[model samples]
Target: MGVRFSKFPLCWWPSSIKSNLHDMSDIDDGNKNEKDHLPGFTEYSLDQLRSTTSGFSPDNIVSEHGEKAPNVVYKGVLEDDRWIAVKRFNKSAWPDSRQFLEEARAVGQLRNERLANLIGCCCEGEERLLVAEFMPNETLSKHLFHWETQPMKWAMRLRVALYLAQALDFCSSKGRALYHDLNAYRILFDQDGNPRLSCFGLMKNSRDGASYSTNLAFTPPEYLRTGRITPESVIYSFGTLLLDLLSGKHIPPSHALDLIRSKNFLPLIDSCLEGHFSNDDGTELVRLASRCLQYEPRERPNAKSLVTALTPLQKETWVPSYVLMGIPDGSASSNQSLSLTPFGEACFRRDFTAIHEILEKLGYKDDEDVANELSFQMWTNQIQETLTSKKHGDSAFRAKDFSTAIDRYTQFIDAGTMVSPTVYARRCFCYLMNQMPQEALGDAMQAQSVSPTWPTAFYLQAAALFSLGMDNDAQESLKDGTTLETRENRN
Candidate 1:
């Protein structure tokens, strides 16, 4: 038996939690942590990560450059409803597991409001992954260059520069002085639209030997000459980011410096930012950028100095980031809650009429495998029997015959000829309708087991948990379902 550790004894847990834990324990065997790590740094399992990210579906990918990126990052939701960003390194990226874990542990220890903090790492077998808090708004690249709503306001751009400087300063203070490829894409906006630096770039992909992905001209001068990254290299990269924020596009550091030297700033500034910033404020920012891009690494200002220089330049100090960016404030209760789907709304309102129509509209499409199998396996009596039972259960479900639906679904499940999450989900709703909260929870758990990433299973669990009076747990489950549903719709 695996050694299990819990802060509280079994008797201390609520009856609902205890029962759910007992029912789901067996399904979690493959998701156990491989080994313990530093305090507060979780060592997640491959299986758990897979389920959280829907087997790393391409549709859930959040990293820029798509498949071509050296490492791909996906957005996922944890069981407890926390959103996470999972970074899966390339197969050959981190060949040394020990080195990978050490690096992860070191970076995981440092946390601040300025960063998308690292929460966990998975290093089981050949897989190497890092998990961090998800930033919802998007990257600086999108907001600065590819904005849909509007160009990021001048005040927001200044805030980004200051925030990034503070983040680098925090890392530097924590003894992690070097940050790889500090670019606009490396900066992300959290749910509140506040900018935070991604922690993924803190860990070097050592095995690859290539550190910088962008143009060599934008890279630190020392790195170009010796192929080595230093603390000053990060500052040099930071200069490029300031230029990106100011110009609304990438400007080669050399070209930008010459423009600054000649006092010809009009061509370097973004047209979108024409009247937003004063000439004096613009000149001050340009001078700071020049200092960061000095030819000699030693002459470059450190992270602390950058923070010092940029602190006084902040605009709209009292304005919230969301307001400045023209986005909804995430802290607002209305924005915090996700908009429910039609089927989800029907379930939430306990509207049997709308539920029946949705079920009919959905039909067996959710169980396409079962429909396809009948074409080739009609001669097999077991397959035929299983399909017939499911059809009957679905009919009963749509007809609002909860008791009959339960009986038919039970028969289909016990047969073991076929497995379908949709069957378990439909039966779960039936159990809820019949006021069998425990049975509803059981069926919902089973549906999750059958299809580990399905949002419907989580939604069903929320309903059952609510009926059981586990209000907090029900809300968590509801949030998890909403998160998964959002990802599915994006696909």
Candidate 2:
């Protein structure tokens, strides 16, 4: 069992990996709650967040504007297989670190079903990043304006408005009155396709500066005059979003108001929604939007009032949002193996033979060094021994002598001359073969710490967790592995 990991570059990972291992311990001890909610507010280390997002790779970017945007968000998977959206701010965005922490901690205290809740924040040196729940279905901007499958249904639009209103109302009740840059982009759909307002807007971008990033047409009138955001300003932005949902495209508030005044409702309404709603229903929604777009911020209705008005107009309230959006239901899809990647499918079925075949085919591809030139470290005697141990381990693993593989791999690991996720992954597989699920799990988690985006590490973890009878966690790991594998293939 030892494999030469010298080909893989050595990395100085942060203590976040230790934190993740501690969390795993909690899970093993049954101390974690099984409910669908974040445990508590976390002040994550910058290195930890960096590892989760694969060093903030462009391939994992989820922001609508991609890398060009002032603030960029990337999709990341935690060691526990939970998806997170990490928003990295510009260097000078939050100069006051203490102020940023205060804002993030306050926002993280909120736990609302209508909001894509803040989970943590990272403030180390010049780095400032916020972590929140990741929405798989994408933003309202994608579904409402640039739909791929089909335009959002009328019932779903109504639900979006109501849920957003509820989210704002919840924030207001919590003494957090101001929301910055509220727009269709701030709205995202959860796994169930239900809309939830992004919690990122709840925090101030700077201590004392302008926060609005959208065009003046979408900006609240009061904000233009004073360069400030208030509760009523959020309501004004909500009205513009109403216009977006009513019409198929982005319309300036002034132009939409003009269309409303001329009673030219035909151009203002989305053509796809024509046969879906009654004239009275459209008129009622139009009336609400007009009220929200009033010239004076004080004249706009509060979040609760908007919620009340939109609630009655909701159609098919009993039906699931995923059903109306024509997306796959997460619960139903979790049981099916048809859409899983090859590695994920093997893990899901616990087919060790298939897993071994796939791993052998992979053969430390990610472990290859970037440069062909040799380094001074390569001449060290310790490096030679480490390479020898790994070579022996690989031979044993291939020959199905798992016990020998384990001993050789342990020697390489204890050498500390090199760090390789492939080594940890191989050792994890060996442990699994020896029927030591806990040992297998430790190695798998270690592999993730060394290389966060390695799909094989996640797949091995799934197999280990399944052997331990942690089927739910195993399924989650399988999903993450499948997603990462798909993304890798795309790139």
Candidate 3:
């Protein structure tokens, strides 16, 4: 069901998707049919596109580059006067006539927020051309690994890491296939300086049509031995990606190379980052990547979990792409970015106490102040993030981790945030679990304050009040209660 897999002297992905790669059989153009359409989306062919440029001619060729090997890239002018990249591979080398069409279809169908979009492909008899959005900066590999370019800063490197993982995630979910290939050579940095993941021609489609092939060398030991394409394989690749990011080098000939596993690899990281990187965080990320690259696919974290792990890093300050913009591959957006704000920098430095103090100051009661919505939401989000982290003073109160109950209510206090009384009543139980009677009472009161006409908040308030031994106030508040759900929940 997966690529043509074999384990002789350790398993590995075949050299070319067009040649050695199997199971990605010669798919016919007719596969694009009524049943094949993605959810709420339509499919298209090159004919539907405005037009395409044709040339093996010297005039149309913009530049020829060689890193691993010589790649002939052509320059074409679109109707919009935009110059695009077209890599015309030798068709004779390909195994099938329809393979190019399928590759085009697979790459073109993906619409990512963080990857370079595949425009279309021209199946000119034997020749196959993959047309793509013209990226000015070329590949991230060029700058990051190049001798002339400045070293990639720590934050910038992290942003690219997030973008790449998200791109792979998008590809994995879209075609129902695993991205078996995630080498640095495939990731191109655009003119706006954002890394755009490319090389989906080798992407493997799963049952749902959104997966990539497993790079055997990068494949976890568990999956390297199997023909299955699991997220763990991607995780293995992610670990390799981390190695690539830190070292600004290609993934080694072997699978599962970690910065921690080999001290030699740790020093291989990009020297341009001023050696300014988190050994702790990088080590954790490396270990996580290593887990994904485990001998078994079952040990790896899924893309969603990867997203959660990388979410905190997203909030930190990263250098803006000098003049480049990132493009979406299959999973990311055309533009994944961050700010260099002072407060953002402080958060990155883990100055939580300073941030907490700022929030407290902003929360001050000002009779003259017309509800500071932005400030309120900022403080609330901060509080929620704090409560979620283990280091936070409040996370110790989990009655089997029921923080979401209070989170929703706390969210309501944010400047622009608003929640119905029903939601507050739900969170009150969470506060009660944490033995936070005062906080529960506050949530209940805020719910009532937001909508005094809502009867449920009063019922919730009554329950909280009674718990606090304010029986008389609870009875008085109950006078306005009427909603059946609230009353039942309260009782």
Best by TM-score: 2
Q: Each prediction's Cα lDDT score? A: 0.78, 0.81, 0.50
Cα shift from native, residue 404, model 2 (Å): 64
Which segments of model 2 are wrong by more than 4 Å? 1-35, 207-209, 333-491
lDDT of 1 by residue, 347-462 (tens): 55567577657656765565654432344554465787887998888778877888999999889888776778788788877877888777777777766665656677777777
Q: Report per-prediction Cα RMSD to one decimal.
A: 18.3, 18.1, 19.3
Estimate the TM-score of every prediction.
Answer: 0.61, 0.62, 0.49
Clashes of each: 0, 11, 49
lDDT-best of 1 and 3: 1
Worst 10 residues of 3 by lDDT: 13-22
Any runs in candidate 1 off by more than 4 Å, and if so which?
A: 1-39, 333-491
* Model 1 per-residue lDDT at 376: 55
Give the per-residue lDDT of model 2 (tens digit) for 1-491: 12223333233211113223224332232222222436688889988899999999999999999999888999998897788999998887889899999999999888777888898999999899999999898889989888887889988888898988888988888888789889888999887777888999999758534677788878888888988778888888888989999997899999999999999889889998879988998898889999999989878899888888888888986576878888877644544633788788788788988887787778888777422343577646578898899999999989888999999989988887677778788888988899987788778777776676778888898898788765646766776676677777988
lDDT of 3 by residue, 1-491 (tens): 12221111222211111111111213322222111111212232344222434534556564425322233566666554555677665444344646546666666767664666666665555555566766666566566677474566667777787888777777667753455456665677665466777754343432222232334455455544555556566667677777777667666525335434664544655566554766666666665556655555676677767767776765233224542233223111221232223322232233434433332343312212234344575566664553243222123222324575355335443423323443444455466556766666665565555444444455555556556654434443443343323333466
Model 3 segments more than 4 A misplaced:
1-54, 58-71, 93-95, 202-231, 251-259, 262-268, 315-319, 323-491
Clashes of 1: 0
Candidate 1 minimal-lDDT segment of 10 residues: 29-38
